[model samples]
Target: MKTAVALTIAGSDSGGGAGIQADLKTFAFNYVHGASVVTCLTAQNTKEVTEVMAVSPNMVKAQFEAVINDIKVDALKTGMLFNQEIISTVADCIKSWGGDNIVIDPVMVSRTGAQLIDDSAVEVMKRELFPQALVLTPNIYEAQLLSCMSIHCLEDMKQAAAKIYDLGAKTVLIKGGAAEGKNKGIDVFFDGQGYTIVGIKAIDTVNNHGTGCSLGAGITAHLALGKSLPRAIASAKEYVTTALEYSLEIGSGCGPIGHFFPLIESQYNG
Candidate 1:
């Protein structure tokens, strides 16, 4: 059987929780070959991101060229594009090489609702990158920034999803993980036709450091493996839920979900 291949253009998490680490793990589980172009290097653990150093635009372009020329990338995901220059470079490369299955995880806001990048980067991403997205996955805070609306309820999330879809992505998934209510983690999906809400009963855990990255990577992996967009989203949601259910308590602060829980469990049980 032939294997699928996926690429991640994202930052590197030194702690191996989110970013390229999580993306590779997710791709591995889906039986897809994983490739990466590191956009930034961050000194972060489960606790917090203390420092970030972005790669040069030329280096970013070099990596993109190396991957595209050698590997047949079935799908790709972007995370933590730190600045306008990097965003523009990536967008140009995608346009040049062609981007069919691009999953854009707008990593603009942190878990605590803090802006990670500036407005200029966000503006550049929207203008240059969003149009290339086959799928756009943004958490609550990111959705708010993109739609310029406060999401207090599920209906609000639906509205945000529509607005974001209008921004150029063929499909928009507004993650409601941060939304407050009885159903605290409902994800709204809009594919230019209508809306669908995907939710698993929220798992209470502080060890969710890489949930967004993992979710987006999983979807990308499935897409590479020939799954439909909606099926990929549903499967990715389930994968994240399971990872959260067996989340790893690694560091002093918020840790990472167990990307390989099922694999480990199988190994141990057998």
Candidate 2:
């Protein structure tokens, strides 16, 4: 039996479609094992997040040690490091043992537009963790937040990605879901040298709750299975597109894309 295990170091979303939930689902659907170290706990429903309490740095470190000692991680995905200490702790651990493929999703704002990270942790993530990531996946808002610049156009996205690269990430994926353009849901990928502009048509449904988390985890799964960076990212984007296409409207505000929608709800049916 061939089993691959990937670890997610992120927060828990009570809504069950994002965060640890979505990561685990993506892992299972991709035929990989999933483990997790929760960095924070959020009091969130389908509509919005009410409160978030970040776990202590010691606990975070302990969780990593436990995972490392028990099972070797094939790949790693990180999301929602809410504070400076937690971010620092994760970065240090990654630096110590970060040989495997790693995808860092800089989760800045929630689907409801609530801030999930502290302002103090931004600098720490840039200096400590971004350099260690195999790929840093930051959405339009997150890119703007990290680079401290307004993203008005695709050019702004490129500039933001370059600025983020200066902070140390080997590669930066600046998502263009919210970029100023006719694009309904196009995302851009940029390394230090050049950039690739990819266009994706919008999914008609409103169930886009955990698309970001699912995308990061899906990409990590492909990388763990030995896919190149570009291929892994392109494939992951396609996976998210299908999930969103079959998204189920669970909440009034915005719902979650089905991570296993391809299997659960066939594209033709749902």
Candidate 3:
């Protein structure tokens, strides 16, 4: 049987919890072959991101071209393109490739609410990339930024999802993981016509370092395997929830969810 291939154009996490590392693990667990184009390098662990250095725009283009030319990417996701130059380069490559099955995770805000990219890069992403996205997955903070409103409740999240849908993405998923109150762990999905509320029992754990990245990657992998957008999102949500249940207490700070939880479970049982 032929294998499906998914690609991740993101950054390298020295911590092995987020970005490219998390993305590849998600893809592998889904039984999809994973390819990567590293957009930036970060020197930090699960605790904090200390230093970040972006790959040159030319190199970003080269990496994207090399992978797209050789492998037939069934689906692809973009993570931390740190600058306007890199975002432009990636958007241009996708346009040139006439790429579809695109999942865009707007990684603008950190888990601690720090701004990761500058305002200018955010503008570039909105203008160049969002329109091309098959699904735009943004956490609550990012959703607030994009929709120009604060989200404090499920209603607010639904409003934000609708507003973001106007930004040209065919579908928008506003992650409420960081939300307070009873609605936490509930995500609002908007796909032009209507909204779907997806909720899972919230797992209490601090070791959710790559939940967003892994969720987006899992969706991409399922899309690569020929699932519909809603099915892909649902499956990915279940996967992330299970991964969170098996969250690894690896680092001193916030650790990472177990991307390979089934394997770990089997090993322990055996």
Candidate 4:
């Protein structure tokens, strides 16, 4: 039997915590083959992103065509679509290739407080890419930007989730990772009919450099493996929580969650 394949169209995180690194790791964890089309490259460490260089829109298109023409993608997700042109390019590619299950991670800002996306691209994403999304996952900050609603509390979260759903996404996962530290990490998933809150006690780990990318990738991985939307997201949160728990200290500043920790544990402990 062949392993199902998933593609991640995102940037390359030289720090190895996020972007293509996280997506590829998450796909492997979920027992799927992973491929990538780099959208940009960043000079980033756990502490800060010093620089970014986006791929040409034409190059992006070429890469996508090269992959799909050769391999079948069971599921796909996008992250860090920086500018309006790239946003338009990717949106067109998705439609032209006839995408399968797609998870859109509205990545606006980085964990280090750096801006990974352009202000103008946000509108293009909503108008072009989001309507075709199977599931849209946004962290609290991104949710606020998308819905124009301040999410200071859980009630605000439910409202934000509903509004984002109305924004044309078939489903929305508004990750509650940034509420007051006293509150747990509760990610809310709202489909058209109802909602669910998958909560995990906040892990006080500085090695959480790529939580957003990891979660979105994990969710896409589950979808590729035949899980329903709800199951995929719930399972993804669990996967990231475990990754955070076993996270390692690598860089001088922050660090990365171990995507293959489970595999490492199994190999060493057994």
Which pairs of residues collide in model 1?
none
Q: Which is better, 2 or 3, measured by lDDT?
A: 3
Evaluated against the true structure, the overall lDDT of model 3 is 0.94
lDDT of 2 by residue, 111-150 (tens): 4445666777777887788878889998888887888898
Which stretches of model 1 miss by more than 4 angstroms?
A: none
- TM-score list, all predictions: 0.98, 0.93, 0.99, 0.96
Q: Go through the candidates in order and give each one's C-alpha lDDT.
A: 0.92, 0.83, 0.94, 0.87
Report the lDDT tens digits of candidate 4 across residue range 179-234: 66555478888888987878876888878878889899998999988898888888
- Please give the range of 10 consecutive residues that has the lowest summed lDDT in model 1: 176-185
CA deviation > 4 Å runs, candidate 3: none
Off by over 4 Å in 4: 112-115
Report the alpha-carbon TM-score of model 4 versus the true structure: 0.96
TM-score of 1: 0.98
Give a tens-digit lDDT track for model 3, residues 1-270: 989999999999999999999999999999999999999999988788889899999999999899988999999999999999999999998888786899999999976778899999999999999999999999999998999998899999999999999999999999888888798788999998888999888999999999999999999999999999999999999999999999999979999999999999999999
Candidates 2 and 3 compared: the better one by TM-score is: 3
Q: Write the per-residue lDDT of candidate 1 for residues 65-101, one digit (tens) a residue.
A: 9999988899999998899999999999989878589
Q: Candidates sorted by TM-score, descending order?
A: 3, 1, 4, 2
Pairwise lDDT winner, candidates 2 and 4: 4
Clashes of 2: 0
Q: Which candidate's lDDT is highest?
A: 3
